[model samples]
Target: MTPNQATSSTTAHLKPTLGSLQLWGIAVGLVISGEYFGWSYGWASAGTLGFTVTALFIAAMYTSFIFSFTELTTAIPHAGGPFAYSKRAFGPLGGFFAGAATLIEFVFAPPAIALAIGAYLNVQFPEINPKTAAVTAYLVFMTLNILGIQIAANFELAVTLLAIFELLVFMGVVSPGFSMSNFTKGGWAGQDHFSLASLPGMFAAIPFAIWFFLAIEGVAMAAEESRNPQRSIPIAYIGGIITLVTLAIGVMVFAGGVGDWTKLANINDPLPQAMKLVVGDNSNWLHMLVWLGLFGLIASFHGIILGYSRQIFALARENYLPLFFAKIHPRFKTPHRAILAGGAIGIAAIYSDELIKIGGQSLTANILTMSVFGALLMYIVSMLSLFKLRRTEPHLVRPFRAPFYPYSPAFALICACICMVTMIYYNLLIFGIFCLFLALAYVYHAMTVGKRSPMQDEADSNSMTTKTPAR
Candidate 1:
């Protein structure tokens, strides 16, 4: 490897030792589970036809973005992820926004996942209440995270396996009752119905559907902990995206058709409802197994918290945030402070009005939509950085350069911008709120804790050395 590649390789395996397969499992689980709410909302918005088209659009964009990230991540395998890449390519200000955007995505995502789990459980046990269940689930995962990375990875692996198994069984039981007529029964045109006019609605749902595909890039956050970051990060990144797209398509194809879109859309956990419809309500065994799927959803949340905390830790180390947040446990070598901070934010979000609401019509729905908007904004910035870096650092060693160069990054940038525009069209208020927060964060970072230039710090160090060479 060249000098830069060697540095990248060394930094990639800087800390705790996590296997490639385990990382891939965690990434897949987090991305798939994050979409539970989106799937339900998309189905409600455009029915089955709308949901399927939206799913395809989001999946395609996500696939392309992951490839772009794979190239960047392998070239510079560091823990700060997009933030580090942006800083190197642009400067501190650009890096601040990228890091802030990531922090928003990670912090908000956990509660969203928790809320989905709570909603699903509430469906099975209405008396328990969604808020209580949501809080309880969040706490459980927080505890798992506090325990440490190895334990979290092991738990994630187990949950992903069970989730995959549950998906297969669901597909098998529902396949026997598949109806070809269901595909075209609802027609391909209308508002409450599925039609060509609904195309806008379908496009609107892309952001929501994209939620399910969010955490695929999270593997990059764990780069510092992976066994062989150059090889491991890219493999996990590509592999995770492929796995999720395949599963999503399979589920959409197997879960009957858009004819009963209204019924399926109304239900929070569509897979269970679809299974119930397929098996005539006589399969008690299937009901229990469907509930097991909830565990998978919870596992996905666990992975989200784990990955998000690491990003926080990385930012802290770079002095973008408080130095205390950079603390790593001496024995565990894990970012306990950052993990606790993430857990606290997640707990707060769980209580937010948006998370407590039921349907997609409430403030919680607005925020969830805004989260998608925020994520796409970050994507736009990161993709731009990729192109900028190529021009500015032509000789920078890149172990894995993105294929097609400008075209690949350009494609991702365009798709992300399109998604953001669609989000604004659907709900201008939410997008406005998202941009407002980012602006506020940028101002805060600039005024309160602007990072010092590396050259200045280097000069100070050299002066000190020259003043006392033998002391």
Candidate 2:
């Protein structure tokens, strides 16, 4: 047998069961949590008006980014997502950094979402501790993911649909209270007027603004398991981005206009709070908002568990992580070990929430910032890979080319660079912590996985080949 055939024969692949519908579910579910809670934190720094402006620019970046990123995803269609793209374009070291950054984005994001899940439940049952609920969420969803992909994906679709419906209902119910005067008053950096002086707060708010659409790129990680990646991926990505952008703007505007926007700016359950302003605390609609809002948080939490596990599995399969994590469950055909490992890290972060304070920010805020930092770095790397591969691998089969080519990716790249700089400036301590983690990861890579010879590296890459050929 050929060496590539032998290598492929021995490797355990993720079962191909997901299609366009499930792909859309995974894409939107992966990011639905941002709508539930994290984005409101931007209001604290930039106020309603300034934060709205920040969100617009951030939204543009994501719209352009997903359009550009889809090209790389369809061409490679690997579980490693950005790691695989960077590896092809810039070799192993580039892959290592991209993988590390992607890991940070996926791994760190869940704890914050889990905590929000807990906070939402706490609103109804005050006795339930947020941290306990957070850890419980990690355990429950990880088990679901470990059981199988289809089952987990089906669940994601259900919750994502419910979440989307809830947001629409929220906007509809709050329509009466959405006064333009309330929204525009003190909107720009807590001032009635917008000026250059508001720029720092606007810049500082970039990470929170990014929270609105963070992890949407995680959909690419599922490319390996797709039934028809080329067709399904472009559909899922384009449809998902449009859906998320609409919900983000709708929820933000409706909530901000409902009364004092400042009161909803820094809380975990902003939707429920905003709804209570319109419908009263005892209103069934308010209760419904609290209950249904869990769907949004759960969708993102569960979806991210799926995203992070695939990433860990991909890294391990490529030798960047321990081989133990690469093992697929015999009967279930899922990356059980990788799922449990990521869940453990998330649970640890949950327990450490209060303990790991930076700049006096809440655990959700701190972790959200860290996740955005990772995301922005990965975005920069992924766009660079796209540009490099066009020049380097001219013969590569691209089923879906990013429109506007140089300009599309360049705009995405510039925006990502700007966001990264602003995040570092405002979050020095968290940025340092992020750098230290990368440095340690690099050292570990240097000692172990980085030592793979050319032949071995080729074999590893071959073993990771997509199940469906590019169109």
Candidate 3:
């Protein structure tokens, strides 16, 4: 096997053009799609009030998770994000699992967002088939990502501002017509009143709650490309989380309050649907929402494609994946191969589900849950990494630290465990598929890379005179 002597140089060699504001733009832009859809899916599992309760629980989880996670990002400041942390804390195998989960989250996420983009456009102009629109969205964004980080970050900033504005406008327009009665109309769908039976629904609703804040951690993936990741990572990470929580609550209360929350549950474009109900089909608000609301989905879809490429590039640079994925454009200095490769995977995922026509349901939600499953699993592993690192590598420099030390990471870890179990319970089919993929990856690593796990590799590197890859 080729040793990772060049890994450090190649990984750290990435261009660093991103500032704190651009990082904030990418962080927020990466997740603004959550404000668009999928959170309402929780309502299908638990009604409006129950879903709101679930949101609050998840908000706590994310608040704690980001605080704990930021310290790792600031301290480590690697493009691999969770993979680097887990590798440092646990070893190659742990890093693989963490990386795989992140891959599952990022590689699978854009297609879902692409599907949403199509759905949003289709709602405005039915002549546009969602499948066609989704493919187009992938092609356009992949091109933008391939151009350069500077261009991508600038675009992310512009659209992120528009998406944030759109959400505020949505809340304002919907608030005037919101009825408290409508909010509680279906607070708990299956339960006449609160009961023990209602508990599982809350657990089941966890993934949907995750929809509100998924991919926020992806900001860490841009560490190699950031101007001053040490200072910028914490601000962008914390600021992004705060912005999302407020939007999550505002959209939840206002949208549910405007009309039948149950009807809006699980739909592709809940905001537009909710607005149309309140202002009629031809209302200016509906027009503005349908036209501009696309920005929210586009922001996330575009931003996530950028994130996934960096992750793919990072892993490949470390020899965790094929070397071909590590290739950077000579002129652009971007991981063009990784970007195209991820786009190909996303497009294939979109069409495979489209052709199979899974159980007469749109694969968008299923794929979404699948991505959430990966994210929750990664979160659990990463929080564990934080504690492990603190114990084992206490002297490592940390520009930022979690406010509550053990408590913050501990709380996030616990919540991540619960959310992961909940995600598995809710998404058995996808979980099974992910397991099969994991087993195959392990088999491939054992045979090709030999039995030397990431831990062993790190040990080897430390003892060797040759320079090792960046963590």
Question: CA lDDT of each candidate?
Answer: 0.70, 0.89, 0.84
Worst 10 residues of 3 by lDDT: 460-469
TM-score between model 3 and native: 0.94
- Best-to-worst order by lDDT is 2, 3, 1
Query: Which candidate leads in lDDT?
Result: 2
Give the Å error, residue 468, model 3: 19
TM-score of each: 0.88, 0.96, 0.94
Candidates ranked by TM-score: 2, 3, 1
| Model 3 stretches astray by more than 4 angstroms | 1-12, 190-192, 354-361, 450-456, 459-471
Kindly list the per-residue Cα lDDT of model 2 for residues 17-108, writing each as its tens digit: 88999999999999988888988888988988899999999999999999999999988888999999988788889989999999999999
Instruction: State residue 276's C-alpha deviation in candidate 3, in Å.
Output: 0.9
What pairs collide in candidate 2?
49-187
| Native-structure RMSD, model 2 | 2.2
